[model samples]
Structures are given as structure tokens and as C-alpha cells.
Target: MTKDQLKLRSLILTALFAAIIGIMAQLFIPLPLVPITGQTLAIGLAATILGSRYGTISVLLYLAIGAAGVPVFAEFSGGVSKLVGPTGGYLIGYIPTVFIMGLYLEKTSFTIKNAMIANTIGMIITLIFGTAWLKIAANLSWTAAFMTGFMPFIIVGLVKAFLASWIGILTRQRLISAKLLFPERLKEKDNKVA
Candidate 1:
């Protein structure tokens, strides 16, 4: 398949996944500031499968949609207000996390053994930027900021990361196998990668 076809298909899939992630925001746990949702799982899945470029684009597009007043954020929240809210930093952090996770997925061979490690590292990246942004935006000290913004979601993040990594590895394997063994999707696009 041609690179262009692959890029287009990847972008479409990424956008679909972004919408799915946004919709998952409806399943939220109440807490201080931002509630937890299953969105990050989709973010990780996109990064692992689509690589950095399209994966990041997917996330950016999702945020743009939300910022444009689409109810695509957690708790059915959207618009510019949500972007400037306390959780905005965390929302923004998703962009870099997905990109970095994609880099890891591409650079290192994905295996069950490394999945947890990769997820942990990626989670840390998200939290760092998120926590820092939360601090500045909320005008709180680092400790207080982390307690309010980061602590509440640690357990949930771990659970979702585990699930994301597992699913990511499985999905990647399936896609690679399909692309190589079947190539039907490629043939439809005239043997293009997309």
C-alpha cells in the first residue's frame, strides 16, 4: 500500500478512536476537580497502533472538537471553558503522552514484558505535564496540586494503563498479521498501506 493511503486510513481510525474516547467520558467517577474516565485507554491504544504522527493528530482533533463546543469530554463537558478549567492541563497532557508512547512503541519491540513499563512511563509523562499545568492554572503548590489533581486518579490510571497496554499489544499483533497475511485492506486501496 502507498504511504498516503495508509496515512489517510490511520487518520480516520484515529479520529474514530478519539470520538470513542470522548464518549467514554460519560463513565466517570466523582471526585475533586476532574473525574476519571476510560479515555486514556483509547489514547494509549491509538499511540501504540498508529504511531506518533497520526496518534497525536487524533488526540488534537478530539480536543479541537471538544474545544469547539462538542460534548466530547468527560462528564459530558465541552467548549472553551473546559479547556481553561482545572483539568485542562491534564486534557492537554494527552497530546504529548500519546506522542511519546508512540515513539516508545515504534522504537522498542512491543512485548507483554515491556507493556507495563511502557505504560508506566507514558503515564508518568502525562501526569508530570498535567500536574504541573494544574499547579500553575489552579495557583496551588506542587504538593497540594498533586493531591487534588493527581492522587485521585492514580489507581484508576494504573488499571486503565494495564488494560490499554494489553489491548494495545493484542490489537497491534492482529493488525500486523492482517496486513501481512491477508492484505485485503491493502488490496482494496490498490495494495496501499492505509
Candidate 2:
């Protein structure tokens, strides 16, 4: 593909992933502290499939859309107020979450171990940001915030992370087969061979 063609394709893919995140957000199980949503799964998919740069771009785009008063968040909620609401921390946390996952998958071969570790780390960072935000935004005590935000979601988060890791690596393999990924990676391999 030509340079411009490659750039266009990348742009389209990034936008698609951003849309996926937005759509996935609508699938939420509302809870007291935080909504159990498919956002993390989409985040994992985008980062694993697109890698750091494009994954980060996709997430930023998703946030921008939501910040623009679009009803794209969980339970079809939206607007800038959502960003400052109790759940806003989790929304913002998606940025760093994608960065960690994408960076790890970008540099290393996808494996259950790698994906789980990276995802676990990312989930921790996201929860920390989320819990802190809950305390400040909702005026809750640290223990309260932890109980409400962190404690409730641990097992589900692990399950989602595991699913994301498995699905992401599998999707990447399909992308490679379709010639939609691994050009640069293949080039690196060829360079080593030569």
C-alpha cells in the first residue's frame, strides 16, 4: 500500500475501534459505585489489536466523543458532566489503561501470560485512578471508596481481563492472516533473518 493509503486505513481502523468502545459502553450493569461495563473489554481489544499509538488514539477519540455531549457512555449517559461525575474517573482511567496494555502488546508477542500481566497492571492503575476520583468527587472516605469501587469489581475485572487477553490475541492472529497487521513486525523478522 502507498503511504497515504496506509495512513487512511490506520485512521479508519482507529475510528472503528473508538466506535466499538462507545458502543460497548452501552452494555453496562448498573451498580452503586461503578457500573459494570464492557468498556474494559473493548479497551483491551483496541489496545491489543492497534498497539500503543493507535490504541491510545482510539481511546482518546472515544473520550472526545463522549465529552462532546454524546450519549455514548454506559446506560446511554453522556455530556461533560459525566466526566466529572463519580464514574468519570473510570472514563479518564481508560486512557492510561489502553496505554499500558498497548505498550506491552506492541513490544512483546501476545501470550496469555503477557496479556494477563499487562491487563492486571492496567486494571490496577485504572482502579487506583477510579478509586481516588470516587473519594474526591463523591466526598467519600478512602475505605468507602475502596469498598464501593475497588472491592466490588475485582473478580469480574479479572474475568474480563482474561477474556480480553484471549480474544485480543486471537483477533490479532486473524488480522495477521488477513494481511491487515504485522507488516512492520514481519519486516523486523526479515531484517533479523537477513
Candidate 3:
């Protein structure tokens, strides 16, 4: 594809992922301090499929939409209040989580193993941000934060991480085959081979 076509494809895919994140955010099992939402799964998929640049852009777009009071957050919450709310850290943390996950895959390989590692790390990063913010925002003690925010989600997060990595790699491979997404590393390898 030409440069303009590629840019348009990126833009469309970015917007689609952003919408996917928002939709996934709505699927939540409500907890006392925080809800376990499918947002993380979508985030993982975005990174694994879109890589660093477009993945991060998709996350930012999702956040911007939520910040604009579009009710795209978990439990149908939104606006700047939600951004600065107790769960705000988790929301904000998606940025680095997606970026690092995508960057990790980009630097290494877009295999299931690498995606698993990246998603696991991304899960930890999100929990750290969420737990820390939950402590301060809710005025809870460290132990309380750890117990409420961090402990409960470990197993669930691990499951989600696995799902993301497995599904993500499969989907990414298909997309690459279909020419919907192209990895820079693959391009470089092609050029070198040529």
C-alpha cells in the first residue's frame, strides 16, 4: 500500500481498537474497590496486534473519549472525574501498559511466548498503578490496598493475560497474512532478504 493508504488504515484500525476498548470496559465484575473489566484484555490485543505506535494511540484515544464524558469507562462511568477517581490510576496506567507491551513485542518477536511475557508485565503494571491510586484515593492503608486491589486480581489477571497472549498472537498472525497489519521488523527482514 502507499503511504497515504497506510496512514488511513492505521487511523481506522486505531479508532476501531479504541472503540473495542470502550466496549470491553463495560464488561466488568464489580468489586468493592475496583472492577475486573475486559479493558485489559482489549489493551493486550491492541498492543499485540497494532504494535507500539498504533497501540498506544488507540489507548490514548480511548482515554480521551472517556475523559470527554462519553461514558466509556467501567460501569458506564466517564468524564474527568473518572479519570481522577479512585480507579483513575488504572485508567491512566493503560497508556504505559499498552506501550510497553507493544514495545516489548516489537523489540523481540510477536510470538505467543513474548506476548505472554508482555501481557503479564502489563497486568502487573496496571495493578501497581491501580493499587497505589486506590490506596491514596480511598484513604486506605497499604495492607488494605494490597489486599483489596492487588491480591484479588492476581489469578484473574493471569487468566486474562494468557487469553490475551493466545488470542492476540493468533489474530495478529492472521492479520499479517491478510496484509491488514505489517510489522516493521518483518519489513526490515524482507528488505534485507531482497
The prediction achieving the highest TM-score against the true structure is: 3
Report the lDDT of model 2 for residue 58.
95
Cand. 1 Cα-lDDT:
0.74
TM-score sort, best first: 3, 2, 1
Candidate 2 local lDDT, 1-194, one digit each (tens):
78778777778889999999999998889897789999988988887777778889999999999999888889887889999999899989989889988788667656666777778877887889899999999999999999998998889889988888778777766776686664355423221200
Best by lDDT: 3
Q: Write out the backbone clash pairs for model 1.
A: 1-191, 1-192, 1-193, 2-192, 5-194, 6-194
TM-score of every model? Answer: 0.85, 0.92, 0.94
- lDDT per residue as tens, model 3, 9-126: 8789899999999999999999888999999999999998898899999999999999999989998888999988899999999999999999998887788888889999999999
Mind giving the per-residue lDDT tens digits that candidate 1 earns over 68-91? Answer: 999999888799988788888878
Error of 3 at 119 (Å): 0.2
Off by more than 4 A, model 1: 180-194
Candidate 1, residue 153: lDDT: 71
lDDT of 3 at 135: 92
lDDT of 1 at 181: 20
